[model samples]
Target: MASDTNELFPIPAYCKTIVGSEDGTIEDSPLQKLEISNPARILQLCEGLTDRTTKKLEIKINKYLQAETDASSVFMINLLTVSEEAMVQVVGDNILETSIRTPLSEDTISDIVEYKDNSLKCAEKLDPKLQTLINEIVTKDTGDLNIVPIVAKERRANIPKKTIVSPVYLVCFVNSSKDNRYITTLVHETFKYCLALLLNTRECEEERRLKQQCQSLLAVARKLFSHLGDLNDLLKEIMSEARRLTNAERCSLFLLDPDHMHLVAKVFDGMSPAEKNTEVRIAKDQGIAGHVAATGTILNIKNAYKHPLFYKGIDEATGFKTRNILCFPIRDEDTIVGVAQLCNKMDGHFDYFDEQVANAFSIYCGISIMHSLVYKRIQDAQARSQLSNELMMYHMQVSDQDVADVVTCPNSHDLPNFESFSFVPRRVFHRETPCFVLEMFERLDLIDHFRIKRDTLARFILYARKGYRDVPYHNWQHAFSVAHFAFLCLRNFQLVEKGYLSKLEALAYLISCLCHDIDHRGTTNAFQQQSNSVLASLYSSEGSVMERHHLSQTICTLNTEGCNFLESLSREDYIKCLDLIKNMILATDLAIHYKLHSRQLAMAQEGFTRSNPEHRYYLCSLLMTCADLSDQTKDWPETKKVAQLIYTEFFMQGDLERKMGKQPVDMMNREKASIPDHQLEFLTECCICIFRILSTIFPSAKTLVDSITRNIIAWESSKNVFDKLRVEGCTSYDVLISEELERQVQATLECMQDP
Candidate 1:
């Protein structure tokens, strides 16, 4: 049975029978029908009917010359169609002697104006001698086939060697009649052999062309099979071959992104590095490739701009001008797998020969894609396993023995001000933070209420803390701070007791906060994508790459030995717990928060219902975001300090992006970023809407909102101060902000002491 949700559509059981082969056709192995051991052949389409009417004409023309004019008196043996510039004589020798020919009229000249227009323009520039000859033929009304040689000789008096007339009528004329014949002096049998030679030469040329195509196909097949790995590399090879086969200036390959059910351009030839790295997705019914994939027909475009479906966005973005295009579908058996597009043929528009090669080339692409996809699955599984084991060995070497001492909950007396929204973990003894985290669980009665084993809970914290990289802002300290804020809300907001949140919800919320920044690399999601990090490659399609990795790390820690904190819960509760954890963790991604802001606000305005799942999700999402940005609600000094840490990380990423020749966003660019103004924008635009929404829901949470509102003022003041500094020759601002932030922290602390 096909799994509708499976990315590979019909390959639902692929991973089940992945080892070696099952019936020699395991989905994770090379396709048996593909015959990796054999070369593929392009199926020959039906041969077209040749124009053998010319052969029969060769016979009749010979008879007419041997006999007199009007030889077949029952019918007109010769007919002439005259234009203003040229006279064309044609006769259908296919008709029997009794058949009558239609006589040419004066109106016939205007009927063929399209064929004569260019010829008429050129004839106007002809020399006097050719003009006289053309006039004589028209005056005498004797534009016969024999007079063509005289007309051509007169026409070429201007440029004799450069002009040679093609003879559709006289190329094989063998005039044995000596009375009035002047066109040819050849004997009867000689013409037959010349025609035979012409036929043989055309056949040989066609044979050689097909043989070349076969050789090219054979070589490309071997290359696709022998290539080592990497889907991008295989696609580039496909693009190169497509371009070579089509003689095109550029080529691109669009494949079905099984996940999105859309065509994504995986690789492009003749593109810049950044453009190549960028992924472009279009519907299977949207663009040129879309047309081909949707209809299963080739579109050979002469002028791309004039085509209805052609859009200039891609050309403008990539700095490539598209004059022409030839797009065709790639198929595997009955399934149309993808599309190959060729642009700008070197000589002219893609003709029949190029289309045939491209059609055959698409077969190679489809088979290679199948092989590459299967190989990638096998390699990804092995790499993830090896990387996980290696990452565990390298990053998470701590064990039960190491965390056993810290696993014991601290006495509650030693942990004061724990439920305050204004609590700053930076002031606490660094070594006692883990115990305080445990006591958070203890206070929530999570340790007792949910039957969370104390030692396992402690180990989970240590693993999560270890999971965070030592970055400036999103390190262990930041994760702990975020977790502390969530604990305060759970303890002070009385959400769980008031039925606004369940114990499981609170547990998921706290755990989500604790692990949300795990394994962070001090970079934004955009940075991860720009740099093409492993995390981005893994989760970028689903989006929120860093946040998703944090969640993955949380799961990895929970499953680690002695750290299955959620294992005590029932299966249903465990699944729900992880689901909430995933949602809450992803909610910390500000991008998601910005998207959900309007929904959160509307729900808050509409009133929260504990029974409404949407209400619960929006409320929980709101709480998670508020907790993540809790540092912003701290007192002035801590707010400035945290701002320094964040901007420091942002600027560092900006420097790295600059080194890679990519322009960072305004807020990330250290030199251009006005710290105070950016923060004010963030606070006013992106942050305040959600915080205000939170305030509307829980009136007591207004204290959290109040703190942010005050800090917004200080940022407004700092903007003025920074502007003055820049006027006085401050070139780089984040550094100036860093220096001024430390000074302001001390000054604010002193003022508070004096008060």
Candidate 2:
């Protein structure tokens, strides 16, 4: 009866039998399967065990085995329910004579207890160590086998009501046997699957974490690339991001100070704010960061204390203990601009990944740093330029005492009528030229009407006088004379009353006259351009070299603290005044004079009015030109004196030109000059035309034209006598007939003068 029962329920082919030895050893027997007399019925039963069901069962078995405390024992338990009753069985070499059975109505615990009792009985025949481990597992509660509870629930859901069902868990035991290697292999293989599943889950989580870290790195890179600020702020942000990215406890960003060939710590995140600013500099070949900067290489050191190139001075100074270091160079193009040094990592020592991230971040750091450095340099240069301008203004400022002297000087009430042909400014004002200017301002009521500050006006006049170079013709005296001529035009022509010029225009005209030739170098525009002087280079493109320089110098003088007389004007009025002054002064350029004169003549033909800006500009230019050459319209003695002074200036320029290997023009060359002939040409071509245009504008200015015409006649007579003397073999006019010519010219001038 026993042989018949064993053949009917043979062990499955997948099951292996463990044979026990007498010396407490267990060995694996050959696999065998029970013969099914009805092969078709066995195949039908196997079809019910699908791959999904088998996988779930395997997972449950592995979970239970892993939960067991004993490493030597593996358990495989299968629970089957048939006809409202459940059967529990352990799949192994040993099998109970009767399967543990319980009613479906009763709890599954009864079936599990019955199975444990049967498993203990079978374990007694195995090796002592294996038997002991099984006994412990069966007797003890071993806590609830909660592993794969979801799989248990899933299997329970699949069971049909009132039908046979089986839930299987396989367990294996490895005993202390010399020939139990196969059993040990089975045990290890089962646990290896569980470990692999656990490892796979952990790897997914690690992958997610790495992706997040990469995103963070990308964000940091974007911010660093777009960073636009000063160097200090940028460096601090870079170091902070580097520390956070690499999980470093401390970070230092050092810039290569190319000037000193040293590494300077621009930012030290580990240091306190007070200590951060402390100067930290290292030679380019000295330390780790310096080495990186010098060599442009990345250094990942596991232990900074162990590295020979590690710099410990900063650590000592800051009370920071650095365990590891990751240093890399920051590069702009091919040049290394700085280095980033990361100290001990928070979690572990710096690794290759950290080094790679630092290397990538340094690229953006270098660009940001380079941009910040360039920006800082630009700001510094602008500050220096502003400071230089301020210093220039400071030096050019007029003193308070000089201003006080001019303001306090007695006003000359007995000033000559500047509009008269015989008006001599040098004879009238004498040494009190500035005083006469003040009286003119007072006579025009400009000091009150324009809200001019007395001290500022006085300072302006004194500074204007001082601004003139000690040239032969275009000096302080000449400036004063031109100003007097402008004043004469203002007073005599009724320009302001007749609405030909506004009060502001009149004031600008006078101021322009005073400052037009403030810093004359006794050289013409052509001479300045030919010599390529500083003034010419500055204003040559604008077409009025000396005139523009004079205007610039005038602006500089007015900018002086005590000499800014026009400061009282409203913003609009001030701008208009400056514009008028610019136009009036620039018109003094002879190159511009003909254009202005033509424009004025056209405007005069079209009925010019002060309300028209173009007409006003044309008139202002004409007035400035007329005043500039007013000496030509003076009496013969004054005209003759001016001509001599002008010739002296021309001769000096000619000498300079000859020394520079340049040919002097006819008027400028002393050796080639005929004074009388040059004077005749100047009066006809320049002076007479200027007076003729002015006479057309202001009919009262005809007297100026008449005076200039009479001077031209006097020059013509002198030229005739000079020609006669030259033909008569008189080699020199000074030695022969000079007295006679002087007497003749003096009689002609005395008759022409207003008596």
Candidate 3:
């Protein structure tokens, strides 16, 4: 299957051999009796009217067309929309080459002056011989270019009575072609590619212009920044650049004086140099500038003298009449800082297009006005970069021998439960877990398929192991378990084979599962509020603090020297993979998972399409969460041990919270917490509910549901033990309940054996 639709574009098809019929006997006719026709005209589509811009395009199409037909040009060229997609006709005697008349006739001038609104009508209005060209072009797919051969009786002028069956071949410039097609296919197919190139060229030119404008804006910003220490120089520079960009005869930069409720500017463009330093003030509601400053609105007035908001006192004092004005409020976010007013536009009046240019310029003006703090922010950003580099020193590189230690693929038979969803990852030694990860990569051929260098892949695996802090349930052991679950789901369910996931998505899934809890503090999101670290400060306000930290740690590893496994991917694919990893890891947060999972489940019940990106995202999130909580799907003994470990960390946090005069939640408070109740509630609401959803989407996951149900039974039995012991005056019964559960499993298996 194709990786993407773009990869499928240029595969050519020569359908004539398969779809064409064999009806007539082939014959070789004399060269003089044959004539080949090529309708190689072009119609450019944009906003302008210069058709000659396509003259070179027309010649190229004609050349390719002749190669297709083995013939000469037959039809005339008529194209439009070449000038930014426009139709501009070159008039005078040159246009009448259709007849080559000597002096210009009145009818010819009238024809030159006449205009048609659209392309179809214009094609019909062209020379009458090829009037059907446009209609023919619209009827066929432009890419399915085909040539047709026609036979007709031709007689020379010397012997006008004799009839001869000569052929005229109509050739189109497709990479391949079909027969018995109309001339319209030839017309559109030739013009389609040529005009498309012109359109691309036009887009490039537009991009160049935008880059030039950006460079100019940057230059203006630099000049203004240099003058920040001197308000006089800064104000003068701001007014000069603003006036030049908007094409105004005079301009003023007015600062909002909040204390006195007036607009002030130290420099005015229309005043003499001697008066330039004098401050000008107007009431907050007096003139156009004042209105803009007060209300924070941009206004372009065509006739300034007639507007009701116009204040004529300044014009009367300066003895200069203001014919037009464009006034805009300069802002720092929502707060109005100043107003830029332009008077008497040099070209007609100011327009909306001018407003856009001035608005961009206003950003620098606002920066100049607010320079007291922005310069410090720029310096702080640079310092942040240096600090980020220093932090990277902790993400150490794995030695070559460390990579070689795990690089050898392990035997599948020796690695029991390696591919099983019910596998207990904590049983495997922490150092050996990286070997299993490497084996899984080799099992899926991820290293070879994604162009990941062998050493880079191994170093990344080692880096991931080290990135995790040693915690009760959120460390390297938990990370490897989650990743192993993802690996099984991918391999067993035929997710890639059935098109539910792409290779990039599967790669991201495994990576996210392995690194989702990196550097986790073994507590809740409380660290984000209580700690003052850089990671918390960067991601705290965004919410999903712990999940975001996991993603950041994953990125930091990839950005390290030898652990950069994703460097071989193209820019687009690399970005898409990173985005997928971020979203999937973040979705491991239960709140985010529920929001998208429910909506996606509703849609899936209706009908699911893996092709839809939103559906795929939801599916990936569900898988990530399932992988995260995968221990609930293991055997009863493992599940019991996992619960004890989770509560072990919880009780530790509760003890610390109590010491700090804080009330810990019941689940974490060892004295108040009932293990059976909390265990049952979590199983019923989170574990069982999630596994049921997974089974609904992928039936192979039904085994996970069975394991959860068995665990729920164990929790219920524990509840019974707790209630009985409490009545008998014993408070601790959790371990006794686990032993009883083991007894029940053994008895049930023996009874099945007897049957």
The local distance difference test score of model 2 is 0.68
Model 2 bad stretches (over 4 Å)? 1-399, 416-421, 724-738, 747-755
Overlapping backbone residue pairs in candidate 3 total 15
- The local distance difference test score of each candidate is 0.69, 0.68, 0.67
lDDT for position 540 in model 2 = 64
What tens-digit string does per-residue lDDT give for candidate 3 at 1-755? 54454333322232122211253322233321211222212222222323444334334445545545433332222321111111111111122222111122224222422321122223334443222432333244434333332223345576678964432212223323323232333433444335455444545655775687788889999898998765667888888888877778988888888888889887888798888757778888877888888777788887888899887887898899999898998887658888998888786667554677788888888877789345545654664565457545655657888988777645443466667786677888777888788877878778889888888888898988888776787878889889999999999887787889998899999999999998787878774466445555556546787888788778988987888999999999999999999999999998787777677667557665877877888789889989999999997778877887888778777787787788889888877778878888998988888888788888789999988887777667666566666667653325433466457654554454594
The residue-by-residue lDDT of candidate 2 on 332-439, one tens digit each, is: 987999888888888666655576677778877877888877776676566445634754654465678767777887654574455464688867644588878887
Model 2 earns a TM-score of 0.48
User: Which residue pairs show collisions in model 1?
Assistant: none
Residue 206 displacement (Å), model 1: 7.6
lDDT of 1 by residue, 366-439 (tens): 88888877887776677567657766766856666758877644455355665788778767776677887887
User: Least lDDT summed over 10 consecutive residues: which range in candidate 1?
Assistant: 37-46
Give the TM-score ranking, best first: 1, 3, 2
Where does model 3 exceed 4 Å of error? 1-397, 409-414, 530-534, 724-755
